[model samples]
Every structure is written in structure tokens, then in C-alpha cells.
Target: MELRHLRYFTVVAETGGFGRAARMLHVAQSAISEQIRDLERELGVSLFNRENRRVRLTHEGEQFLEDARTVLDAANRAVTNMQRSQRGELGKLTVGFFVGGMGPFFSSIIREFRRVYPGIQVSLVEMAPGMQYQALQAGSIDVSFTRALPAIHASQLRSEPLRNEPFYAVLLRTHPLARKKTISIRELSEETFVLNDRRYSPAVFDKVITLCTEAGFSPKIGATGSVSSGVIALVEAGEGVAILPQGSRILSSSDIVWIPLSDKDAVIDMVLAWSPKLEQPALRSFLELVRRRRKQVGI
Candidate 1:
């Protein structure tokens, strides 16, 4: 039907109720209901099942939600594109990230880029590593700061390696292992290890596991966290020790100490990833700033 119908459907599906969706859309409750009814009738399918004062999407509705949201989002972006055309810059850039990627360089690059291109709006979204790849393919993200290496179809996209950061073992200040000037993967056999959630450090997890396996002992992975800050905080609380990539030293807690791995001095290459199909001038400038910041920081 009309674009308004798609908007109403998305609002309803997201809020899961006509009354609340109406409040969010600032439309009359009856109007919201009328639009959804029109949408369902036009599609010859029921989108929602109403039961016991709760609402949920049917199987057909669940499958169609993504298509509807895409149509609505594309329409909105078209409007922004027209305005950006007048300003000669991209309207918006959505960049995805995980914690260990680019660390300080990521923020510095964005700050400098926005300073020069105030008209272009940039949004940062933090998602899991696998989700970052999925988001990029889904057109939900334009660029990503990720530890995923180029071998994983990363070469198919437009990307540049920003820096390589060595991994370090972070231990609690009170732990006996903390007294050591340096540690190795084999030495961490009995240590409780905090793992980073797979989205932020997929490569790290794989590498750590592989290294531990090669050393004749599997690391005792204990607590887990989605962000580097959370892992560091857990280490400070004595829950477990964690392996951190280089540049994360900047986020060190006062009660924790970082020691390099003697035998496992492996590192990850921080990279900036984007689709070559995405040719926004502001996005291009943003990537340039990342390179400039790397040079400035002597990375």
C-alpha cells in the first residue's frame, strides 16, 4: 500500500501493541490500527496474533518484517540523501565496532573527520564480530573497525590495515602470577581466564584456544564479557585474568597489571572495513582520517 502503512507496521512490530505504537508514532491509536489492517489486507496475510493482552508476530509476519523495515529505512535515507546532495557530503555513515579495534585511533579519527565535515552525521554501533559482518552485508552498516583479518572475504571489501597490536596477559595485582615480569601461554594452565565475547574478539578467542591447545593445556576460561572494559573490570575484581590486545593498555585498571606473553607474542591487525559499493565522500574522508591518525600516533 502506501509508505505510511509500512512505517505503521514497523512501529507496531517493534512496540508490539497498537496503543503503545500509536503513542510512539504520535498518531491516533485508531489510525495506527487502520493502517495495519490495510497492510494485512493488501498482503492477504495476518501479520500479528493478538492474545491475552500481548502481541507477537506470526511466522509470515516475522519473515516480512525485515523487508518492510528495509523499504521504510531506504525511503528515509533517500530524503536525507537529497539534503546531502545540496551540501555535497554524505548524509550519514554507520560504523560498526568491537572493543579491541583501533582503540584510541578510532575515536581520534572520528573526532577529526566530524570537525572537518560537520554536515555529515556519523553513528557508531558496537555489535558482536559475527554481527558486524552480517550488518555490513545487510546494508545496516557502511564501515567497521574490526580485528577480523582479510582472509575471511575481507579482501572483497574496501579496507586498510591500521595497526598491529600485540596481545598481553592482564592479571590481578594480588595474584601470584602478577609478580612475574612476563608470562607464557603454558604458565596460564591453572589460571582462571576471562574470555571476551565472540563478537568483539573472535580472532583472539580462536588464537588463545589454539595456542593453549598447542601448549599441552587448554586455558581455564571462566568469566566472560562483551566488552574489553568489562573483562578488565572482572580481572580487577579477581574473577579471572584476560588476554588483551595492544592499545588496550590505555584502558588499564589501577588494580590490574598487564604482562606480555613470552611464547605467544601474537598480534592482531586493526582494520577499517567498508564496501567498495559505498562511495560517500564523507565516508572516504573518515577513512583518510584513520590513516592520518595512525601516522600521528606512530602506529
Candidate 2:
């Protein structure tokens, strides 16, 4: 029999009479009696013993009642979980981001999201821009925080401006240029540049070259590191100076200084990108939270 049959049977059993079950269910007494009768017919068993004004469950009915409650409870839980998933409250969300690329606001936004939507399990993957693009395409990740994506993937994904991180002149605190409030791109031409390997961060590496070229000089390459912190470490040891994003300052040290670039185009856009085909409810929730805090992070 259908769920309504079990529901009516349980309600009649609970209330000890068809009349009260009908009142509690806001239905006609005849309708409740018909459904309960249908249930018993389907089972080929007498479920209740009718007396003068009330009914008592049979041995079979008592056992069926427990099973009915279990089934109903499971069905209710399944419906509740489905609704919560649709509301972006229950599910898994995988996000791919460049290491140290999201800057300060990224952490804050993630913290708030975790607090507000504790039911959504969040997994973070650290990927370069290229890998982020591929992960989005392959459905391995739901969202990515990255720099400008390749033109080929541009049309296939939707992106929003997250932050505009300006390039910085990284130097030893003892260096004369470190004392300047802002150092123009031209002033650092004579300095050797320490950089993260291009494979790890090709966008930043290319941007550094373009900025120096526009300043009428080619930066002399002194060393290369596999990561941002490695590059910063080289600069700290007086190996060479580095031109990095403003967010790189998060790897702060008293021996190093970060000065903003003066050139107009000395900036890069950090964006949040996701494949339209992979936009899940949980991802939508995250995007909403970012939009709310977008202005605070200079989006």
C-alpha cells in the first residue's frame, strides 16, 4: 500500500479511534477508514480489533507499526536532506586556488562561509592558473581563484573580479630604494630580479617582464625559486630584488620591504572563475558570500 495508508493506520493506532485520527489529519472519518481498510486488504491481514467506540492493534499490526514508523522516519530525513542541498546548505564544494594568490580577504570569506554553512564540506586545492583551468574543465573543482585564464577557456567559464593586486618592489630593508614610499618601475632596472620559476606562476612572471620592458630596461635574472616564499627567501638573503604582487607581502619579514609600483599598468586582476556546466548549489552560495564582501576587498 502507499505511504498514506501507513500514515492513516499509524494515526488511527496512535489516537485509538478512526474519528480522532480523521480530526487530527483534517480528513473525513470515512476517508481514513477507507485507507486503513485498503492497507489491511493489501496485506491480507486484519490489522485492528474494532470494539464499541475504539480499536486496538492486532499482533501483525503492532509489528507493522514499528516498521511503518522506521520507513516514514527515513523518508522524512531523505526529503529534508534534498531540500537542504538545494538551498546550498548540505553538500561538498571543491575550490582550486593558487598558493598565496587569494590574498587576505580570501581567508576571511572562507572563514565566514564555514561558520554560516557548516553543513557544506569544503575542500581546497592549491593549483596554478593553468591547472585551475583544467580542473574546472574536468569537473575536479567547483571554483577557482586565479589570474586571467587562457583565451581558449575564457568563453567557456564565468568569472568575477575578486581583487586588483598591484605589483610591488621587494627589496632588502637596508637598500636605499626601500626607504621610498613608492618606487617607480624605472628605479629598479639596475637590480637583479629574483623570481618564482615561470612554470609555477607564468602570469606573474610574464607580467614582471612586461613591466620592466615598459620601464625601458630588462631585469637581470639573478635566481629562480619554485615558490613565492622561496623567491622571498632569496631576496631576504640579498641575492636579488623581486617584483611581486602586493599580496606577496603576506610572507612578511623585518629584513624585507614592499613598495608599490608607480606605473599605471603595474597591476593584475585576481578573478574567481568557474565552468558554467559545473556550477552547483554550494558553489552558488559561496559566490553570493563573495559578492557581499566584494567591495570590502576592493573588487
Candidate 3:
């Protein structure tokens, strides 16, 4: 039988009369009586015993009532869950972040998002800038916290500058310039540089080379690491010094020192990038939260 038939039958049983059930349901009494009769004929069982002015449930009616209530409850819950998902209040969001930085800012945004939408599950993946871009294009990740590279121009992708900060020189604690508050880019002319692979972050690699060249000498490249953490590890091992975004300072070890760069133009932009085609309600909710938190923190 149809859900309306079951509903009418339940209401009739509850009110103990078709007249009252019709009044409660805002329907004609004859309509309610006809629906109940149709339900009984379909089920081949009488659901109610009608007296002069009252009604009572038969044995089969009691058993079917509980099952019908269970079905209706489940159906209601399903509808509610679907609506919540559509509203961006429930689901999973996969976010990508660069391996070296994004610790503080990313963590803060995620914490605030979790507070606001606890029903949405957030998962983090550590990827290089290039990999993050690829993941976004391939639908593997919802959004990414990465650097803006000149070579990474995509019509379907959008990038918003989240934070811009100057680069810092990461040096071994035993290095002579480690004690300095600030070091000029020219001072590193004689020092070997630990660089990140260009494929991993082309913008950072090109910026470092440009800065060194502008300082009147080519950077003596000692070694290249695939990621920022690896570059820091090399610096800690005294392989060479490296210049990284200010946020990279959080990844510093006790054996390494972070000194500000003297060059004013030596800066990098930390960006939030995503594909417009993949914008789901959950991702939109997250983007809105990011904007709100960024404004609150004056980022």
C-alpha cells in the first residue's frame, strides 16, 4: 500500500475514528474512510474494528503499525541527511597542503572550520606544490594550500593569496652568519645553497635563482631536495644554506637558525587554490569559513 494509505490508517487508529483522523489530517471524512478501506483490501486484512462511534486495531494491524512507523522514521531520516548534505553540513572534504609550510595558517583555518561544521569530515594530504595542482585537476583533492607558480596557469583553477611573507635563510647553527639577525642575499654568494627541486616548486626555485643572480653572483647549488622538509634536513646536516618562506621557520630544528632576508622583494605568496568545477557545498562552506577567519585574523 502507499505511504498515504498507511498514514491515514495510522491516524485513524490513533484518533479511534475516521471523522477525527480526517479532521486532524485536513481531509474529508469519506476520503479517509475510502483510503483505509482500499488499504485493507490491498492487504487482504481488516486493520480496524469499527464500532458504533469508535474504532480499535485488529491483531494484524498492531503488527503492521510498528513496521510502518519504522519505515516512515527511516524515510524521514534519509530525507534529513540528504538535505544536510546539500546544505554543506555533512560530508567529507579532502584538502591538500605543501609539505614544508602551512602549519599555522592551515591549522587555524581547519580548527575554525571544524568548530563551525563539525559534521563535515576534513582530511589533510601532504603534497608538493606541483602535486597539489595535479591532485586538484584530477579530482583527488577538494582544495589546496600551495604557492603560486608562473608556469601553473589553468583556466579552470582559481587562486587566492592567503598570506605573503618574506623568505628567510635557513642555516646550520654552527654557520658563522647564523648569529646575525638579518642576512643580505649577497652575503650568501660564497655559501653553497640547498635548493628544492624545480619540479616540486618552480616559482620558489626561480625566485631563489633570481634573487641570488641580482645579488651579483650565481648561487653555488650544493644539493637539491624534492620537498621543503628535505631541504631543511639537508641544511641541518650542514650540506648548505637555503632560503624559504617565513612560514618555513616553524619547521626549523634546534640545530638550524632562521634569519630574515635583507632583500625586500624576496617574498613568496601562500595561496589557496581550487578547481571551480569541483565546487561542492562542503567545499563552498570551507571557502567561506576561510574568508571569514582570514578577515578575523587580519591575514
Candidate 4:
């Protein structure tokens, strides 16, 4: 009926005597005998044959022992797994990240985490900064690599700056400015700026506007792309130039040139964001690992 009942039943059956099981379990012989009697009454079967000094299992006891051992083994494993999960050694960790925003440290951090906590399962979801914040608040994601958390979420979440990324000008190879080693934000004032759609990624949209405004001109909006690839495609079509983070260089091509911005404020901050109440053990372990390697990763 209970785990202890199964445990005592198996121990007594293995030792072949009430006295021996009692000694092995550090209980009185009378107590072990009483427990065995209770077990037999509950199951309505005599589990042991009463021999003078030693006991042998009845036909029913031999069959029950197999199931009893299985149940005990499963119960033991359950307890061990629960303890490991609580200690941040086992469980699943879901991470949300920007499509191209995770900098150099992201891959290294993940590699180290997987190495150190092999028992923990890791999942990655690519999301925009706004979407990442929403997922964090809804508890769908444990942690996120994001940029520009909106003021509305400032009170609900906690974040740490993981990387400060500089902006670059993405232009068609034939564009005159593409020939320049570095371009200032002011130089892009007259050029149509293709930007990520404000609805999907307001932070990037707003930051681009701010940079242009700070450079003494309001950028002419040429088009908007709902996705990063869409933005790149539009730029490749020569619709307009784009101001993107340095990480966007990975999408570079012979037709598209990525020139660093010379403006002093041409930078954006990439942060590791999460809910203040992180209850998952695996999430805590991941955050700790990131902290330990922050200096080494140059973040």
C-alpha cells in the first residue's frame, strides 16, 4: 500500500529472517514482524512461511517481490531526479534570443553551459526584442538575449548588458558611400533608410531615427521589413540603405557592403534579460555561468 511497506517487505524477504531485516534496517525485530504482519493483512496473503529461525517466501511473495522492487527503484529515482533539479543539475532551460543580436559571447556561453550541465536540456527560440520581453513576462521563456527593453517592461523585468554593439551602414556595393572606409550618421541623412518594421521591432526602428535626428536630419523612410531577412532583401534590391548592428555583418554579401559608423553614439546595447522571479533551476545555472565567463568573453 505504501512505499515503506514495499521496502520493508523486500528487505525482510531478502534477508530471510525478521531479526536480520530489523538489524539491517536498524529497527527492532518485533517492529519488523509487526510491519510484515500488517502488510500480509492489507494484501490478504501470507508473504512468508514461518520457519523456526529463518523464513522462506510464499508463492505469492515471490511474485510480489518483483513488482515491489520495481516500484522501490522508480521511487528512488524520482527522489534523486527531483533533488538534482532543485540543485540546478537537471531540467529544461528555454532561452529566447534576437535573430542576429546575440554577439560573440552567446555561442561560447551556450557551449560552456552544455558542457558543465550535460543533464539539463537546452532550447533556443529566436525572437525580436519586444517579443522576447513579452515571452519573458508570460513565462514562456526563462531568459533572453535582447536589446532595448521598453520602459513599460523596465519595472517587470531585470536585465544585464552583455554586449555593446556598434552600428554599421549596410549599402549596395554600387552606392557611392559604400566606397568610404567609414560613414557618419549625418552622411546617410539624404539616403532613404530601410528599417525593420516598427510593429515587430520598435527599438531598432526608434534607435535608427534617434541616430539620424542626432545627426541633424530626419531620415527619409524608404520601406520597412517585418523580418531581418526581408530587410536585407529590400536593401539588396537597392530600395534603400540600412543602419544595422555590427552583428548584422554575418548577412553581408558582395552586393551589400557593411561600413562601420564613425559617429560617437552609433552604438546599441545588447542585454541578457529575464524575469525577476526565476524559479527554474536550469535558468539559474545558466545565468551563473554567464556571470562567471563575462570577463573572459569580453562582455
TM-score of each: 0.62, 0.83, 0.89, 0.95
Which of the two, 2 or 3, has more TM-score? Answer: 3
Query: CA lDDT of each candidate?
Result: 0.79, 0.87, 0.87, 0.87
The best candidate by TM-score is: 4
Give me the runs in candidate 4 sitting further than 4 Å from their true place.
none
Question: Residue-wise lDDT of candidate 2 within 1-299, one digit each (tens)?
Answer: 78898889989999999999999999999999899888888899989999657799999999999999998899899999999999999999998887668767878888999999999999999877767887898999999888876677898888987878888888999998878989888988888999878776777888889888988998899998777889999999999999888777778789998999889999988999999998889999999999988866555
lDDT at residue 100 of model 4 (Cα atoms): 81
Q: The CA-based lDDT of model 3 is what?
A: 0.87
Candidate 4: Cα lDDT at 241: 92
Candidate 1 residue-wise lDDT, 1-299, digit = tens: 98988888888899889999989989999989888988899899999998747689999999889999889889998998787755546568888986556566677777887887787888999876666766776779988987655256565566677777788889888888888887887888888899887765677777777777887998888888777888898898888889888677767877988898887446766777787776566676677677777787887
Report how far residue 298 has shifted in candidate 1, in Å: 5.2
lDDT of 4 by residue, 160-236 (tens): 88878888989998998778999898988889989988777777888889988888999898899876677888999
Q: In model 1, which residue pairs have backbone atoms overlapping below 3 Å?
A: 128-199, 129-199
TM-score: the better of candidates 1 and 3: 3
RMSD to the hidden true structure, all candidates: 17.1, 3.1, 2.3, 1.4
lDDT value, residue 122 of candidate 1: 85
Q: How does candidate 1 fare on TM-score?
A: 0.62
Ranked by lDDT, the better of candidates 1 and 2 is: 2
Shift of residue 1 alpha carbon in model 1, Å? 29
> Candidate 1 vs candidate 2: which has greater TM-score?
2
Candidate 1 lDDT (Cα, 0 to 1) = 0.79
